[model samples]
Target: MKIVNAKEAGEQEIERLLTKAAFDQVELNPKIREANRKLFGRDMSAAELVRQIVRDVRNEGDKAVIHYTELIDRVRFTPEDFLVTEEEFQAAKDEADPDVVASLQKAAENVRRYHQEQKPKSWMTYRDAGSILGQAIIPLDRVGIYVPGGTAAYPSSVIMNAMPAVVAGVREIIMMVPPKNGKINPYVLVAARAAGIKKIYKIGGAQAIAAMAFGTETIPRVDKITGPGNIFVTLAKKEVYGHVDIDMLAGPSEILILADKTADPVYTAADMLSQAEHDPLASSIVITDDAGLAERVAKELEKQLADLPRREIAQASLDRNGLIVIAEDMRQALHFANVSAPEHMELLTEQPFQLLPYVRHAGAVFLGAYSPEPLGDYFAGPNHVLPTGGTARYYSVLNVETFMKRTSIISYTQPALSDVSSDIIRLAETEGLQAHANAIRLRRK
Candidate 1:
């Protein structure tokens, strides 16, 4: 990662480096583009491909879902092959290492416990003239979670997405994972079991999103869909959003570290690489007032990446999106960090907690040298499905509330209605809502 002096950089330059066009429409890489050309017989944007796949699934149901599974993922499935059977779950349990299963169970329990506190409480209050105002918290009846599957397995994704729904009291939840080698990853299955997910479909990609949104012959419709995936999956979620609720349009993973002279370069470089290793688009950045620390961290990053298994991806990410900004001071560092609005932020300074009150925007904040991003990603019990691509300014991390809806409760006695009748009628009439005035007027009578 190259180090740039923040004072020398123009505002436009900083923005272009940090917040520029991260949300620009997803583009397919050359390999995927070639695959798309061969499969669809034409070149199309990621949005175009997603729209066609979603429309096909909307119209042809399971048949279209199976067709895309073969074309996109290179995995074949019949309608009956969609839903994972009990035997598969059992096999996953049997095949999984006993210690790993136990660890996942513990992590899931921590997630469940954390989300239980986030469950919104319903309360009613008596008001003047026998009026009562309240809210009813209703859990979604059913929800679908899309767990990405390819060459990797992330049981943590399952735990992060599912536990909140389970804690919110969702009645039924199903999972969709892209099949790899004609079978779902056993560790993911182990996580599903730990998180209390029942129905799982081996189907995946944009078609899996569409099946959940519109409902198929085999897969049932759901109220919301959560979990992160590749660009195509994100685009599909964007297309089907109005038809179904989505957690957030999360982009590639990223981390921004605000460090001071006291911060350790080795720890800082390791943390930065943690996010960079996620994807080639993933961004790893450091903002520090110390130019010496900046140089040391950059050197440490080069040294550490030499032996990392995913060095190619991490190196590509660093070359493309990573940087170190030499800020003037801690205050300036915080200012630049808030402007970036990163998904995962680390405060590695003399007083991490003292800086907390100034943090304006971030999906999750990691405090101190010991609290790395992965702590929250796996065992820390916070939802890792966070807003990225500078969307942290308005979006939120997924939580129990993501699966729960609140409905207002209104109850008014005759006296209460009379007290406000004229006011309501006057406002309704002022707005040209004659029917609304009539309803209140008739009720008054």
Candidate 2:
């Protein structure tokens, strides 16, 4: 990692670095334009596939869903197997480690409690002339939570995805994860059941997303899909977006630590590696004002990486995207951090609270060295599903709001219409919208 002084980078360099690049260009500079020519650049091949699946499911319903599930997942299952029963959930819950079950139970509770505070309430106002306006927040009838099943059973995702829907009062929460040899992970199953999820399907990848979006024989259609997955799954979600609402097009996990000389090297190192172990594409960087502190943190990172079980993966990520930028001062450090808009931002400074006001963009912010990013991932009360690949500048971490929709209500009485009719007609006519002008003009009398 090179320690570059932000002031020396120049305004042009800063602009180039800070500007959000296309999603594919984050870690590597690919010959994408060339590659696209070879592989049909910027086309809707994926979208076409999702459209076909949706049509099949919409027309054929359950039978089409089952056929796709069999073709895609290669797992044969009846409808009974799709919806996990209370007995099956209990068995999975019982089979899990007592300590792990306890931990997951606690994590689910904390997640639910935090999201409960985020629940939107319905409000309305009525005027003396009988004009009324309001907003009604309504949860989706059914929601699908996709948990990655095969490689590592992400029980944390279960809590992060399902708890918000639960808090938002979503009626039916369905879960789909790829089955390992046709069986779901006991821990994942237990966690889902604990998080108030009523359904679990053994499917994964783009096929799983397709099923959720289109609703095959075994899986019912979901109003929205929420969770993380691999490139194919992510791309599938991106493709099927309009057919069903999606949380976000998540990329590889990332963490940016903004620390001062007073920050702990050990904690910073550990936090950086947390995202690094997720995947080689995952990025971990630190912005600091002290060069010596950067060196210390880099040394600690190397030392810590050596001992980690996923050292090879973490090392690859650190070697490629990881950086320690030494800024001229704290102001420059914060400026760089905002431009990056990392998925996870940790303020490991002497005064984390004081520095927080300057943070313009980040999916989630961890205050103080003790508040590690992983605390939000598992045991802490915040959602771990955050925007990645610089989308944090506009997107937010998954919350209860993600699972619900808002509808605006407006009612204008004769008096209200009389008050604003002439203004409305004038504005409409100015825009050459005669029909709009006539609509208001007719009501004026």
Quote model 2's TM-score: 0.87
Residue 424 CA displacement from its true place in model 1, Å: 0.8
Name model 1 segments beyond 4 Å from true: 23-25, 28-32
Clash counts for the predictions, in order: 0, 4
- lDDT (CA) per prediction: 0.91, 0.82
- lDDT by residue for model 1 over 1-445, one digit each (tens)? 6679978985557656778555462373566567678889998777788999999999999999989999878888899988889999999988999999988988898898888888889999999999999999999999999999864788899999999998999999999999997899999999998888889999888999999999999989999999999888898999999999999887888999999999999999999999998888888999999999999999999999999999999998899889999987888888889999999999999999999999999999999999999999989888899999999999999999999999999999999999999999999999999999999999887
Which runs in model 2 stand beyond 4 Å of their true positions? 1-87
Error of 1 at 300 (Å): 0.8
> C-alpha displacement of 47 in model 1, angstroms?
0.7
Candidates' TM-scores? 0.98, 0.87
Best-fitting candidate, measured by lDDT? 1
RMSD per candidate (Å) reads 1.2, 4.1
